[model samples]
Target chain A: MGEQLRKTPYHDLHVRNGGKMVPFAGWSMPVQFRNGILHEHRKVRGSAGVFDVSHMGRIYFRGPGAVAFVNYLITNNLERIGRGRLLYGALCNHDGGIIDDVTVYHLGDEILMVVNAANADAVWKWASELKPGDVEMVDATSDLAQIALQGPQAESCLAAPFDAAVKDVGYYGYAHVSWEGAQILISRNGYTGEDGFEIYVPTQLAVPLWETLFRWGSAAQLEPVGLGARDSLRMEVNYALYGNELNTDVSPLEAGLRWVVKLKKGDFVGREALLAQKKAGLRRTLVGFEVAGKRLPRHGHPIRSGAEEIGVVTSGGYCPSLDRGMGMGFVPPELAEIGTPLAIDARGALLEAKVVERPFYRKGSVKR
Target chain B: MEFPERLRYTKEHEWVRVEGDEVVFGITDFAQDQLGDIVYIELPEPGASLQRMDAFGSVEAVKTVTDLYAPVSCEVVAVNEALTDDPARVNNSPYGDGWMVRAKLGDAAQLDELLSAEAYQKLVAELGG
Candidate 1:
């Protein structure tokens, strides 16, 4: 497994700091550190936590046709976004099926797409096929490393490193700042539902930057987080994961990402199919439910409405914050209503569950 | 990782201590350390019958879950109700307050098949615990 798995630039640092390296999306990533997922999670919620997200793919689109090509490929309307703003949307196939969920950063002249690690190569290949000759596509995944500083103290922790006014970067906004004479990109957004910054730096500076953040943010109790805590954090906020919620088989509408789908905006990939899907109505929709029992509903677990198996759990686990077994899964429209009673068949035992409003842990300081 | 000398062990990483006709059991320290920050635990109720090597309960950590196997056939006399409210006890005290179940021993001969502290340590070492 180690031979096939790819390591990030901070691999040595992760191992030295007791990050339990595990196989994830063809990359060997730290699932959790020596402090454990619970500790790391509380650190992010209470103070600050840093994540080495270099494993995610960064594809840059440049040249004359860059904006037009990106506008046509993604479901969200890019014309609404200005330079230095970030947009979250999905790349859908012509049939309205989600190809991959992406976070597109409008960095003035170039567009940087941060895609999931599992779908990096696949996304690149898919885009390359549709890429126009005028647009130059460059996969900068190996050239640069990304770090996420999350929590309420994220601004202060990140601000200590640079003289630039990082606090000015509003939610879903970004700015280029210089640290140690090297220019780096800092985006005020994250998946943890915290006030955070996603830093993009050159590969060679990854280690020094990681060390500097810890040194600067030690007073705020910032620690290195891993994928395990990352998953739990996102689940708490009901954020959709790549294979879990948004997949090739599911449409973005059914995955509860209708906000990103701009039907009024000009035609784009999956526009027709999505319009057709809208006319036909969604057969199954994603719903958040909490298990009443101690046992958690895991992925692929059967979800039942009375005695009949209605749907399958797309993502399920014990939310450390909520202190309950909660998860999101696809169920029929009739059963997707909040307050609807449901059940998760955990092996032979049927745990009582109920559909509830998303973001199982709500008190996130995402905007503030 | 404490492997108590008086306790008997299984390859699945459960430990049992025999006292007269009854036995007390729980997961080993190494097992808890590997599982990391247990959030929930599912255990059989009192009076539940168990067979040797049968899954009597399960430990749910944040990332994954594992079944706790019964070391010997017995009737569950009581369960550690404290774990329901505070599951982290298993991580904080795997050998002490984290004890899962108290049961009446069905066969005294099954104890011979269990590994001693020294032998269990070797097994843990082989598994890179």
Candidate 2:
């Protein structure tokens, strides 16, 4: 608490735009603007919204062993995706507990790993100790600034500013675009579950790029969003947040991220433990539930079934787009079935909730 | 943010008003501004008794929750039902239609303990409002 919080390149811009700043993952970041989180959330779902994602750590890997090294580090099969594409996976310890969930971007000669800001140092330390002689690592977090332009109008919002055919970027695919002497990487991906683009720009060009996007996107109703809306937007789609759904105490399999784990692709850091856990069967699994009332179910709230205290809430809050209270939590497999009735202890009040499908909102345009 | 000159206030950021035999209160504009957009509110039912400084209700913003403290000892006579469907009133009209609870005034001396608008504004300024 005595240490000074890190600030992103857009810190001044955010403050000038009426952003309500808060401490998040060691960074002084905006939780919402004057329009508030609800407006920003709906803007992303209906039109477009831009977010400063520079706080997330970006590490670039190169050399002949880059591909092999990343494959060994993550649970996903890198062979499944070719150059210009990215895959979501988790980095786990030998005990199969997740260290952090990351998105690995394959760029042919170089590979980029985007990690959670809170676990950046831990992840870098873990990778550094396991680095091969032929592999090279570059922590480009401070050197670059990232922005995510998202929603139904994302393509139109981004098309006019860059040289590349922004609409042609496939989901999870990226393209290198040159803009006014600046080299930028635009990836057609986002955490909001909307059709969007994540742009990685040089730190020096970050402010200009952000202003340019807004100036060009003004016609498309693009607004600046913050972490408050960002959290709710991802929770609506049942995305697993690192510290909440995944942590040193939780396994990827138990977190309902099995699709990213390719055990058949040969050896990985947590392969043996994952295999052992698979054989033993999971005792608890992550499930999404919707509360019957308006009370926002918060993290660490106790989950009760009849008279027994079963589990605890990981990510829970009011989903502004859905206009309801929903959340994700880990519970016994039998209790995770859809339609299972549950209650969350919010303070002394019990909020009624029921287990539902994986995603609380299924109308996202990410795959469109 | 508007602070009504007629109302008294507490350090917790709640504004108080004495209306004939009843007293009305709500979170101050500064409190609402600090809380960002309010999403939900939970207040005690009518006839619920509360002591001075007791938590009688709660206000829920998108990212956080804050307890609403009582300004003085009283019996809750009525709660603002409008907030049940539109909690944003706390952010939009904290001093007007957004009032939280109406109660029969208790221990008139407690009213003297509440800060006047001038004094409340000073408190807010000291808190870096």
| Fnat, one value per model | 1.00, 0.88
Model 1 chain B scores worst on lDDT over the 10 consecutive residues at B1-10
| Model 2 docking tier (incorrect/acceptable/medium/high) | high
Q: Candidate 1 residues A148-182, lDDT tens each? A: 99998888886665645687898999999887878
* lDDT tens per residue, model 2, A242-339: 98999988899999999999999989999999999999999899999999977889999999999899999999988887888899999999999899
Which portions of model 1 miss their true places by more than 4 Å?
Answer: none
Error of 1 at A271 (Å): 1.3
- Interface quality of candidate 1 as DockQ: 0.88
* Per-residue lDDT of candidate 2, residues B15-67 (tens digit): 99999878999999999989888999999999999999999889989888999
- lDDT, residue B2, candidate 1: 85
Q: Stretches of candidate 2 above 4 Å error?
A: none
Candidate 2 chain A has its poorest 10 consecutive residues by lDDT at A158-167
TM-score, B chain, candidate 2?
0.97
